[model samples]
Target: MKPQSMLFTIYGEYVRHYGGEIWVGSLTRLMGEFGLSEQAVRAAISRMLKQGWLVSRKVGNRGYYAMSPRGQKRLDEAAARIYRQDSQVWNGTWCMVSYNIPEERRQLRDQLRKELSWMGFGMLSTSTWISPNDLADRVREITVTYEITDYVEIFNCQHLGWSHPGDLVEKCWNIDEMNQAYQEFIEIYRPQYEDILQKIQNGQEIPDNYCFVEKTKLVHEYRKFLFIDPDFPKELLPDVWLAADADQLFQDYYTLLNPCANRFFDSVYEPCPLVEANEVNS
Candidate 1:
């Protein structure tokens, strides 16, 4: 999710839970808890209310808001999209950089710090800053409110304490869910992998060129349009559930993708070569 969307999604979830326009003071408190400002919180809320992402009701000179059905659906869709299999193992050093926090929100900050600490965070150089496990998603929820997206980069330092740079986005899902999803995902990939392995064993190789066609255009098109990043692998594939039923999955992924794949084949078919990164001792 984008930073703004992240901010609203958090607030929207809160409103949905509370079931009313939260008091302005409460909203401000939440903003502070997340190391955000009153102005930023108000603007995000106003934007959400305006976009019909939330519906607001004025009660005693304050507006209480909650997400519409559309907003709920939006969040559900995002959950499905955002929660994917873990790409690799955990490195255990993701940091949260908090800035411009207010003095009065000290209690909230302390509480947040404690929660993160309980979640296995360590004290970094900052007086209040905390370093959690090496996944950026939790830190990103706060960063999202602050309008920081894609601020990720390969970072490693002695003061910061790291062995090598890492990618956090690929490890964002809840660990348990990730483990389950990954097992399922791997199981789904096994047959395809076996088939590919057999082809290689039989001295057959993937063709360098095609007859200007692909198997699954809908999967490809829907992915590119609905998702901004759309960073898919070279070979078009279906989801775990779909791929679980291999033959059916293959057919569906291909049949639904013909016309669209043909249309874009001229432009977007580059084969990706996967490389393994060497382990570094931190």
Candidate 2:
């Protein structure tokens, strides 16, 4: 992973629990497991600060990094989707966005499209996007951000005449490819799952360093889904969805690894209020 991406992955998985702050030494040491040099890690941190995703503070002679309020808000929004367990209760309604931008505003148009996709809207045509979830507020935010409220329209409607909802899903998303990716993830991480389970059953504790390294790796692997999968509702997904299985596996492994990983973090950084490991299962 790129150092910046790895940095965010680390924050989302571990650092957020510590009030979204960590000493530079601890951050660099943790990132070292990913084969990133301390210099590279520092550079990445600098970039993040410049991008307003992180803020730096000095205490005595030690330097620490904290997520900016903007960064914290983004992470909080992502957590809702990443950790959501129950299937969405789809109301059989679809939200659509249609836009026509002038050539002079093509850059803003591109930005709008990207933001829409991140909000789980899939393109149905060159100028149209759709989602199962209500996206009025999200669309309002996007339009306000891009100053394109006059160029776009949002609608909530149900499919009636031509193509089936299933067909529309297939056209908008590459479910087959996503399924294969989930299968690949299972192949790669299934052994780690079994090994961790065996160790737990034997009443053996994972070493602090190894636990830290593996936990980072686990989060890195799973976080890729945030970009690649829009995480559509189960009712919209195929009959044999591998993503569901993958999510369950992630939950089980993450729950088991939490205690050991926290031990390693406490060694490197000053501990704050602890979030109970069992909270994940809840």
Candidate 3:
């Protein structure tokens, strides 16, 4: 429960915001806003306890509950794994391709593109794509997993209408450097993340008013969790990244987020290169 201790306001909007202590009275007030009765809130709290997600103590007329050690440990693992989101390297080519995706699968197409951006793939020209990770490998994994073969032919260019990067590592690695700039965020937020792990498991939908602020912080907070090494680099990346296979990494990232959101994009789309930046710079 250490990730987000400084900012109670962060989850205050998500869960019933409580003062240091939570009694039936406090939970009652908070739940009342949601039309939840005190008994209902108490039952939920007890359910959290049975799940080993929280530990509660009694202080006179009130009961105070917080994340149990086990709950905290679970969140810690999630935070660590979040940083290691992608386990592969990028190739020089951005790995852009086009496909005649079925019209009915429109939702899947958009979800695909959005997840790609989250994974750091950038759009070059029109639909032309570029990313630190190898596009060839990503496509291979997707084709095999989804069992669609038509998309296989699109990325293969006769004379390079589109191309990889001079050095994909350099561009993507810069983001890691930017992540290190936020040490304060890590320290303050880890506890909060731990504390919320229990609440997240409570099965209560996020209250409506809490959506914007809470999600923003979660995105940013979770961003911290996804940073493998905030200190990576900005100047130059390893030459080996050019040779790494991206297919598997893409599959893994795709799988990780698939449970949360659907893939999206218009078509197995391709955009003309804005300016095929010089052939794979080292």
Best by TM-score: 2
Model 1: worst 10 consecutive residues (lDDT sum): 209-218
Worst 10 residues of 3 by lDDT: 262-271
**What would the per-residue lDDT of candidate 2 be over residues 60-178, giving only the tens digit for each residue?**
55677888887887677677778876866788889999999999999999989888877777789999988888877878876986799999998998988587777888888777888
What does candidate 1 score on TM?
A: 0.29
lDDT (Cα, 0-100) at 265 in candidate 3: 11
Please report the TM-score between candidate 3 and the true structure.
Answer: 0.31
List the pairs of residues colliding in candidate 2.
Answer: none
lDDT of 1 by residue, 1-282 (tens): 232454544443334434423455655554454456788877887887676677665543444555667677555544443333333443443455544445665655565554444333434434434333342565555445444333322222223433222222223212334335435544654565466447657987444222122222112222222222221221212233232243234344444333443444333322222224642211
- Every model's Cα RMSD, please? 19.8, 6.2, 20.8
* TM-score of each model, in listed order: 0.29, 0.88, 0.31
RMSD of 2: 6.2
Stretch of 10 with least lDDT, candidate 2:
273-282
Q: Of the pair 2 and 3, which is ahead by TM-score?
A: 2
lDDT (Cα atoms) of all candidates against the true structure: 0.42, 0.81, 0.41
